[model samples]
Target: MTSRGPIVGRGRSVSRRTFLASAGVTVAAAAGMRGGPLAHAADAVPPQLTVAVIGDGRTGVWASLRAGAGGRNLEQDLGTRIIWQPGFTASLPVMEAVKAGAVDFTFATATAVVNAVPARVPIVPLAAYPLPADEVDFLVQANSAIRTAADLKGKKIAHQNGTTGTYSLIKYLESAGLRLSDVQAVSLSGADAFTAFAQGSIDGWIHWQPATALALTKLGDKARLLSDVKTYDYAFYVARGEVAVNYPQVLAKFMKIIRETQAYIFAHPAESVALWASQGGFPPNGTEQAVYEKLVRDARLSESTAVALKPVDEAAAASTQDLADNFHALGVLPNKVDVRSFLLGAQFDAAKQAVALALGA
Candidate 1:
């Protein structure tokens, strides 16, 4: 019998369901009856890397590089094309996508990496960029009585649970000899938490950059940061383990491009800020861009010019291990995790050396 496949166009939705169900199988079958990064054939043409992009914050890498000359000529330079998948909203979703072999690369936070360690997600950390310490803060309403971290006791604070915000709150409280249970912790998404805090429902909001930047820009003097950047975490450029093991040149080329781009931005701060102003995903134009311009002018961002590929280095691992221990104490993480074991291996070491060579280091 000649079959033109199932007539899925009709109202018989079951046929449509059956047809859709075979789509994954069809894709796998087409790819030699295998799926994900591990299935790449040795002689296959260089794969198009599916990169995940987050919208809200910590967007410096994906957003800036995409719009810069650093990202141009990727196919010619790296032998790979990029398929940008934006709107993940959070790094967790991106990490999950990488685990499921849906994404090839993006920046994931150190906290996110620590969390992933226990979940057994297949990820390879290529480089670690410490979150700009000065760019983050714990913010309070200008008129609020809470003048310091110590004042946060028994106060209503809004934070996204199991995120950097929670880490900020915990560490700040610990510095003041306080604990998580001492305050009224309200768990909400970043946007919602900001709204509640701004509306006076919550006493404070603790979070990383762009959120802190947004509050300062929109609220002006009406918003006050409790202190300078409180806790520390790294923004990691990570990839699927298979990508690191199989086609490491792509990842190596990526790190090289990142180093080159950072140098370019450092050399042309004004031009870089101008580009950021024009981009939609970056800190908004006018005031927000003005904030960055001011920072660049003051040379505040100077030290971060040189980027490094860290394969579970001592300092980073120690800090991440402590972070994991603290998150466990807060009852957010079910178990204490060792950040070192999952992040280092022979595959990553080779990737790092390849990246270093690409950077001419």
Candidate 2:
């Protein structure tokens, strides 16, 4: 049943009732013949693992495609199906899923994980994609007279409250010698942020690609790149630490498929862009192409799965730490927690190694 390579789109259906019934029969048969506790424990292991995913944006779409593709490969390699649960909004919701035992794996940002760790949710990083600073942009209506970062003072701006968008805005404002208090922060998701910017409800919008590109196109001549926050790592894949430990082989196969897909993307940028566009439901008028080029040129996809905490990553970690610290100083985080210990873990290193080896890096 070995697959030739990773599958690259939405997964086929395997009804839960059917899968559970089969699993019950297999477990019963294994238990009847088991010779020891270890054997019994092995016999009790589930036949499939469930992974939760957020909505159908680029990240979610890519994740779903890779997981489905990878799961097929893994089923051949490990004799099991990887179930997926889709339609999540943010990492916080993913964290909620992990906490409730509804999902075994998902992706999130380092900062979000840090915020979650101190709450004792037990998650760990699986892999990282280092996004260079210029990959994310702060944008305003192109026709607006807001020429510099300083001009944002007293202006309303839209941003997702607890995401890279927020941090990017904070850093952009601070660098311009302005505090968040200097500008009105209008909290909005990437989608809503785009809408707000278009309606002129917000003078500026800070967001990542796809959404940024979409907004710019929607605004036509009304949108312009304000500041590119060239100092953040956009996102990372993560799993509940215990789930990863309990299912190393499953995680390994998943990483292998992701590595393959990443290689495919690098080798076939145009095709990859098309795939992203299709998955994300973007229009074919070159919007996806524009965003893909901007991101591909600036974002560094790992060539190897060596999730070593690179200096830049560490610096990003420190910057996030600083953000948390500032939040505490400003009474944002309810109670202060050790930001370092809250986010640091070894799962990323293991996942990195698995991906690197799979890709022959």
Residues 155-271, candidate 1: write the lDDT tens digits.
988887777677777878888899999999988877887778778898888776556666778777788877644657666777776455455566777787776666666666667
The positional error of residue 207 in candidate 1, measured at the CA in angstroms, is: 1.3
Per-residue alpha-carbon lDDT of model 2 for 246-318, expressed as tens digits? Answer: 3444565566555555555555555656655656545654765666545554443322222332211455456
TM-score of 2: 0.73
lDDT values, one for every candidate:
0.65, 0.57
Q: What ranges in model 1 sit over 4 Å off?
A: 1-45, 56-59, 70-72, 281-285, 295-311
